[model samples]
Target: MQLPIKKTIDSVPGGMMIVPLTIGCLINTFAPDTAGFFGSFTGALFNGALPILAVFYVCMGSTISFKTLPRVAGKGGVLLGSKILMGILCGVVLGHFLGEVPITSGWFAGLSTLAVVAAINDTNGGLYMALMGQYGTADEAAAYSVMSLESGPFLTMVTLGAAGLSAFPWQTLVGAILPLAAGIVIGNLDHKMRDFLSRATPVMIPFFAFALGASLDLHQVWQAGLLGLALGLFVLVVSGIVMLVADKTTGGNGVAGLAAASTAGNAAAVPTLVASANHAYAAAAAPATVLVAASVIVTSILTPPLTAWWARRVGAKAQL
Candidate 1:
């Protein structure tokens, strides 16, 4: 008997399942109780696979020379910084206005930071480069993608916490930064492992996505009605405006298309890390994770068209 290798979800990059998986989640409105329809095991895949694939993408460019980091960081640093600043601003404003109604400090921080995080995922950008036939835009996104691995969390915690949207823990900060350092090490020294993980990570996506969708009371995304619809529309409109401005400023580096399609989402890490520091927020963990999970599925579907449209408007071509 021959041993068989399973061709699970990992074999497909941008697959058929993503659409229904992403949009079906919105059905939580009509179904109200239908969250997690994708199941735990499938949810687990979404949770675990994203970061692994992220690291794998990083490894692909390790050979470009470590020295380029400064340049990469310099140019990409602005994008990351902008993300953090915008998140902080939004979190603070939303928190203050809502004033502990449906809003908690963590709520503000979570959603705000998530906006930026959701808007961008370093790993996803890298994966896009790997699978989507690298173009100038992909490379441009990849350049900054490396910087975002650590920066996303760092910015979220640092800015949000410091701004008082959430509490910041010294120990957790130290711990979180370690993975980024490790990512750099792995990115440079273990390209093969990085590649392997990237390839393997997709297997976990569905599981991750399903779990997040399960948390919401579909009624909230629906019965809450106009607010929920407005929220989604606001996110889209705001993101588009940001993309246009970025495109103009960057001389159409194609970074705008990438930035427009950031879509990293906070994933499990956002709530998990925040909850680790602020025990009061433990309940929010699931929602935060799910929010990010959904963001990714949606972004994956939205990014290509958004990027192309932005690219055309700005006259930028794909870089990587």
Candidate 2:
């Protein structure tokens, strides 16, 4: 008999991402003490997300050819621009109307600039690449290089800063962009090197997803409750729509846009990182982190089938 984990992982749409992530969340939740064992190497391997993602970024970058740079940049740029623009809009509108402590208001009472912006600004690069690999071309998956720039809290910081809510160090921005840039430089220079590293992208995804998920606390899902569910829907519906339109406008079917719609798994950490960078958001950080984590789970589940449906629809139309 084969491992059930493998069967389950292979069965799901974004199973490579969802399965490890689910397992990580379970470990973090039920076996919280497990993190304390082995001098905590298991915890570190699962929780040290940024460094792992940096390596993953390099591998992803290696797959993109300099010859296809324009197309990759174009698609990635459109998705990135739409994500950032939506984030900025939310921040500015909320900041202008509700002030920095927007959570005190009714209905949208549980939300704040940090949580909302972070959730919106980032895209699930792993999920997007997976979806694109299934429903789109290799170049479309390569577009994640651009989308990956939105990985950390940089764009969230920028959105909030523009809204008069917070400020962050420029070095944080540089630190986030460097790995992908290094990968691109190396990948474009050597074909053999690119081919070798490109093979590593799919293989590294589950590890990255596991690491990302380990950083999450499932209890956050409970803490976020209905509001977290709403945020996930907002990302999928609102941001998804914008990306879908941007995709079509930039000469794509709707699949790439839908693929780009999910909130990144790492986004759960953005609120805490943002709080660390700026004291202003410190009070909101804990709850915001939980809420964003919930959003990650929600988006991860929803985006894949939506992309597949759109892909099938587009394919049917083409056949017609």
Candidate 3:
């Protein structure tokens, strides 16, 4: 039997979640103690739902072939580097600007730096590739390009973890490496295995996104005060600058900055770990977590067209 689709489904993936989450946060401002209501919901959903996302990532990896690795190397390097360095550079510029904004405390300043960084989520990266019609190529360029983003989140996690560690915490990285290695092994197996996992991943993606969105406190938007607004505007301006600079330099691989802008989010995994590592910033942890969530939801909506526009302007092969 065919099930009827609700009009609300459109709001689920589109702008509906953003409005509610913002509203949730604002509700928190009136009863400062109530901020935890939305925040805890977010924490439960993201923290609880993330392991499933990890499993999806592992299954997606199960499909990789070693032959594709080299292709990811030559041209892929330039493309991937453009995404990373451009992000870092933009981050640095914003960091410098915020250095003067006194809205954040010393600890918050640290977490915000982490927040601006981007990582390659398998779900978003896959969507980006398909949109750009980059699914199959000599380099498996899209997949490889994604791996570059994939690795950075962990790196960002570790770096943020360091705010209190005083030195690189090899132990945390070591802990994450085993599962990653295991995933790579499974990801490189028989094609059937990879294919099965790939199919399963898409079905699971939205549930997580929706659940994550439901957890956000929309009320925070109002309570976030002037500082959050200032920061959000900074992200918009810096992201635009990145697109302009990248177009000039990369011979134009298509304007990805706009796509990058809409989807600009920290690796969802970073905050809880960072908070655990540094006790002082536990308060900043909730806000950082919400900010990343909002960015992900907002940016996901913004990326498609913004990317297409940039793609046409630069005459790049992909919309990216």
Q: Which candidate leads the pack in lDDT? A: 2
Model 3 has a clash total of 22
Q: How many clashing pairs per prediction, in order?
A: 32, 0, 22
**lDDT on C-alpha atoms for all candidate structures:** 0.46, 0.75, 0.46
lDDT of 3 by residue, 118-234 (tens): 322212453345444631233333434434334314545444333222233577566444444555576576666666675775454454444443444554333444444444445
Task: Estimate, for each residue in 81-122, the C-alpha lDDT of model 2 and write its tens digit.
Answer: 999899989888877765555375455555777788888888
Candidate 1: give its CA RMSD in angstroms. 6.9
Report the C-alpha lDDT of model 1 over 77-111, residue by residue, as the tens digit.
Answer: 55555555556666667556542123334324334
At residue 120, give the lDDT of candidate 1: 34
Query: In terms of lDDT, which candidate is stronger, 1 or 2?
Result: 2
TM-score of 3: 0.65
Q: Pick the candidate with the highest TM-score.
A: 2
* Candidate 2 TM-score to native: 0.76
Q: Against the true structure, candidate 1 has what lDDT? A: 0.46
